[model samples]
Target: MRPVSVRRTVTALVSALALASTAASPAAGAPRTIELVNLGDSFSAAFGTGGLQQVEGVDSCDQGTGRDHVDELGSHPRVEVTLDAACAGYTAQEVEDLVSTKPVREALATADVVTLTMGGNDIGWAEFIGTCSAAAEAESGPAPCDALLAQAPARIAAASSSAAETADAIGTESDARIVVLGYPNLFDDRQDSPLISAGRAAQLNDWTDELNAALAAAVAEEGAVFVDVTDRFRGHGVGSADPWILFAPEAGAHNLHPTERGYLCGYFPGLLSQVARTR
Candidate 1:
């Protein structure tokens, strides 16, 4: 047997070596998968994308069926889509209710990221468009459409309030990184036809800008990221020869929504850029 002093010294050296080896070794666990939860209205619900054609009477918007920008996020290596709570035709108020669903709440508890697109429906965008288009068809001056939307300020205020409230509600249940996406302008600025005059188009675009600003302020106040896709959609609005937005009064099913190419190239790029920044 070795001398007691030699043995004790050897033991200390061996123990130190073992600890050093362990410290130098790579960690032994797999990378944690990011759980992503999507919540909001039609934009998130994939509204006009895919090949969803119109049905006679029923809602052509496939509601929860379409896959929107969430699919883009899930394509990232670190992400897994845990819940997609978005639905067609849902307002901000409706989204608040969606977040209250049992599965959605449960998903939020463990979610690493949550993305939302709301407020458009709350501001009654579709109705506003219908009214404005009708005025345009009548060849009325910008004043008629302007007067029709005279109550816009009040409506915008209510939309803003509801957005902030929804953000607060989401924050309460989720510690996840939240992203709120803003809508793009439906009309471009270049040319003006007799119908939907330049002034009228500008007015419509202005309201959309206001809505985005409100959404940005509300989401920022709640410590969430607000992504504006307006610039991304530039040169590709409703009247552009290669418009990203689909617009045909008869093709009501996808009238105001982004086309598949628009979502993939336009919306997806904007969203992915934000995700990269956050990561």
Candidate 2:
């Protein structure tokens, strides 16, 4: 995998420092308890987006970052950030593993709302993208790209299964309103990079589209709310002049997670909208 970019690390720290003031504190009166529990992968964990709250001893896992949409949700006056069980590089199965733990389960038990954004890693996005890059280099036919697209369906099915199972597990633990967020398209237009062919970008977007569809269906099956952030992130994708999502950052976090702007403009609004309804 690629290292986190220097640009990303600096951006994250600055954004996180700015957003730190938004962290909600209990009001003077008897604290209006709005218990929010977050689960899933790096998106929810606020990895590269900055404002990272490193979990005390668990340096490896980004279970404590608070600058993503989850932080935005917690910014509401009454919301208490009881638990952010999300970790970078986690899949739906890994989320299930975290939820099954005693402390995390306890947090879920008191949760008023739970949000999940997972499955990209499970679908093997990096490997698929790698294949696409290779296909872009090929001077021959569609064989290389076709091989990657062919695997999408099975990948989607497996990921959907894991998502459904995770939803069920969360359901059993808390009566909190669940919201499963979708991934954003990485490119709003054709990439300017010589490394990525038009065909490759289209194929990758197709994979994202399929994954979002499967996730939506799974959330519906579990009677959970599905928040689609795809539209919000449209022109702000990776290839845009001012992309909301980060490309392969070389150090602190994963490659394709949202940027600080993505969380604030793309994810934060959608999630904050749900708070009133879920409550």
Report backbone clashes per prediction: 0, 9
Candidate 1, superposed: residue stretches over 4 Å from native: 1-30, 50-67, 134-144, 193-195, 277-279
Question: Relative to the unseen true structure, what is the C-alpha lDDT of residue 37 in candidate 1, on a scale of 0 to 100?
Answer: 85
After superposition, candidate 2 runs with Cα above 4 Å error? 1-31, 50-60, 63-66, 134-142, 248-252
What tens digits encode model 2's per-residue C-alpha lDDT throughout 1-279?
A: 113553354345434433432333334544345688887887788865654555543335664343667775566556678887777778899888778878888888988888879888788887776666634557645676678789899999999889988998899988998989888887655655444665577778777988999998987898788888988888776667777777754634545668766777778767766655543
> TM-score for all predictions?
0.80, 0.81
Q: State the C-alpha lDDT per candidate.
A: 0.71, 0.73
Clashes of 1: 0
| Top candidate (lDDT) | 2
In terms of lDDT, the poorest run of 10 residues in model 1 is 53-62
Model 2 lowest lDDT segment of ten? 17-26
